[model samples]
Target: MAANENKEYSHKFDECPTCDGDLQYQNEADAECLNCGEVFYHEIRANRHLLWDYDELGWMRGVVSRA
Candidate 1:
């Protein structure tokens, strides 16, 4: 088995589960479906590191401090 086989996998939904619309990034932890206007909020992490912080409207905000 590969070294990464036991690691958790993080994925982004290509289509919205609610409406099957194209998912677009609204912010760091939020996404919106273009067709149905459905919004999704989730924290995505990879390689045991935080990829982005959860924010409703943090497009301009800097990196979030975890301390």
Candidate 2:
């Protein structure tokens, strides 16, 4: 019996390699962009689920307070 430790998988997303624009999720864990016609590949290393989901107002307030 062998213990497996490899869990991380490489993830590829259709992202713009020039401007780093928002990569839209296509369907099969892949993304494509029609803006700049750029392609990219990524890997899933760490996944951090957001707990405190905030809106624009909350984010702005947070920035102002920090400043």
**TM-scores of all candidate predictions against the true structure:** 0.45, 0.30
Candidate 2 C-alpha error for residue 20, in Å: 4.5
| C-alpha positional error of residue 56 in candidate 2 after TM-score superposition, expressed in Å | 39
What tens-digit string does per-residue lDDT give for candidate 2 at 1-67? 1232122222333335445565665443334456754333332324521111123453311110100
lDDT assessment of candidate 1: 0.50
Candidate 1 residue-wise lDDT, 23-54, digit = tens: 78764456677997756554434433222333
Clash number for every model?
A: 0, 3
For model 2, the run of ten residues with the poorest summed lDDT: 58-67
Error of 2 at 62 (Å): 34
Displacement of residue 3 (Cα, Å) in model 1 is: 21
RMSD of 2: 12.7
Quote the positional error of residue 6 for candidate 2 in Å. Answer: 18
Model 2 accuracy (lDDT, Cα) = 0.34
In terms of TM-score, how similar is model 1 to the real structure? Answer: 0.45
